[model samples]
Target: MAAPLSPIVALVRAADPDRFLATLFAPAAQREALFALTGFNHELARAREAASNPMAALIRLQWWRDAVEEARDGRPPRRHEVAEPLHAAIRAGLLDAADLLAMADAREAETAEEGIPSAGAFTAYLRGTAGGWSVAAGRALGVRGEALALLQRLGAAYGLGGVLRGVGRLAARGRCLLPADALAGAGLSMEAVIADPRAAAPLMRAMAEEGAARLAEARAEARRMLPRSAIAAALPAVLAAGDLRRAGDPLVVPGPRGLAARASVIMAGLRGRV
Candidate 1:
């Protein structure tokens, strides 16, 4: 009989269905480890949303950091859904502590009260968190060198698309993820974008276009540099590409769920393009 899904896997499926679906395409031997890593990422990314205050969020982040340190030192992780599986993945050589810790540090940027400082800063944040995770996933799957670099670019594109898709939800929580520079260039402010996203639709559309370009370039590079086995690690890019294609308005949200999204990912996976 197949082993039952772990709590971390369940949480990932619930919180980030796209990534969870992507994990299903991974080799069976690596699927659980990927789920564990992605689940840990979900927990950190959403820490602010779950906390009562900034202090609480910081505490949660610190807890994960400490957990990673313990796992690195060959200690059993604390008995929590994410920590246990994460520890196992680490022990199994499916993940490393430095990448996980860097991801955690990147997530702290999410709690910034003033929002991301600029477009460049937002991109850097995505690189450290999402791109860093992608690199770790690639390494776990035995990809290296140039392929890892391609995966980082793919991850950054995917992360940008994700941020665009989540604009509505983030704004509802009083967070403006649009770059300050981008907003200013459009004669807008963070407050203006948050209060009325329509005012910034053009700017967001442009950003989506840039992300789509990055995705295309990364896909081409992956085809040349990465083997078929490494494709699963970049599967999220398929969904991101789809969202970028459908991005029309800043306020409209990007992802199209149900059969269409699943089919897109499957097709991309079969073609080894993601």
Candidate 2:
């Protein structure tokens, strides 16, 4: 018999795509279970950036870590919701508890780190979190080797895109994720960019340039390993990058309303319409 979906996964499955596409798009059976995993991830992120007490956040993170261990040990967790997806994934050999623990550990580390340091350090943190996330996605998709490589590339690029989009929000919590030296090297400053997204026209443009470059790199790597049929799987990340570029294009004030319409046409073409 197929193992039951975890309550956490069920929570993730219940998320509306428009509300949380990041956690959706899995097979129906795994939907809720995946959702729960993602929900826990989101909770960690929110805890890092939210205004609640630091002590409270630390307590919650500890609770999550302990719960994961319990689930891994084959014991039914006290909080069934958190235990379910984790237990299911473990039984299926879909994920290693160590990977999940690494993620929780990283979140715990963040509560004390305060500010992001050098670009190297930031990238390490980014990769750990982003890689950890893709590991989960990899488990859900049951991919390995080359297919896994594509997913990893897609996840990393997509995660970076999310970080950029979430910069303003992250900053509100007094956290600065922008690699200050890297930005300065690019002749930019977070304060200036944040002060006036328009005033930092060059900076915004530079960001787009960097983002496009990263997307291109990801696309190239993905194309090498992703089969033609897998293009559909790859589309969302490309579409997301396109959205970012289009949003930064000054000429497209309302930002290319036609892009989606055109995308639909292209998708249809790719699917073999005359």
Candidate 3:
């Protein structure tokens, strides 16, 4: 029988299936560490959803921030599924407390009442959250320098595509991930989009195009800079590109299509192109 998955791996597979699938491409020895990192990310990203209100969300985020600090100081992590594995990742030198803390801060920032202010702000947020996580993942995999930079770019592209693809779901909760500038450029407002999603199609299409551009840039850079071992760290690029292609449909979630997604990732891994 297959060995039972640890809590962190189970959490990752349940909460972020795409990433869980992507982790399958990683070197076997590193899979557990990668799951811990991504699972922690999933917990942070969903903190707000699990809370009853914004303040409650902040409290949850603070708990994670404190957990990271405590782990860094040699204290035992909180007795929780996510925290336990996260502490292990840190102790094993697969992750950095500072990076994880920064990610916590980014997750808190995402809980703002105001929607994204501009396209630039959206980009910054993606870089800080997704791009930052990519950096830590690369570090865990022993990637550095130029390869790390490429990973960040790929993360940003993947992040933006994810946000855009989830626009419909976010809209249901009165949340809008598209920046005000993009909305204005498309002649729509957050309120309008939330009330009627059809009004947001043009803007979503534009954001999709932007995500595609970033993916293209990251793909080109990865081909030139990333080493064979780091290819798994950049698998999100293929997933992001596929999502961008379907950005026009608000209800269409962006991810690799099951078997097709897995096949593409395998192909990319073999070719050393994320």
Best lDDT among the predictions, by candidate number:
1
In terms of TM-score, how similar is model 1 to the real structure?
Answer: 0.94
Lowest-lDDT window of 10 residues in candidate 3? 248-257
TM-score, one value per model:
0.94, 0.70, 0.94
Tens-digit lDDT string for candidate 3 (156-251): 888887887888888888777778888888888889888877678877887788779868987887888777776667887788888788777776
TM-score: model 2 vs. ground truth: 0.70
Across residues 89-208, which tens digit of lDDT does each residue of candidate 1 receive? 998888988889988998877777777878788888888877887888888888988888888888888888777777776777777878888888899988987787777778878988
Write one digit per residue (lDDT tens) for candidate 2, span 159-252.
5555555554444444445666766776656664455444334544566577677767776776566544333234446444654564342222
Distance (Å) between predicted and true CA of 84, model 3? 0.4
Candidate with the larger lDDT of 2 and 3 = 3
Which regions of candidate 1 are displaced past 4 Å?
A: 1-3, 253-256
Ranking by lDDT: 1, 3, 2
Worst 10 residues of 1 by lDDT: 247-256
Least lDDT summed over 10 consecutive residues: which range in candidate 2? Answer: 248-257
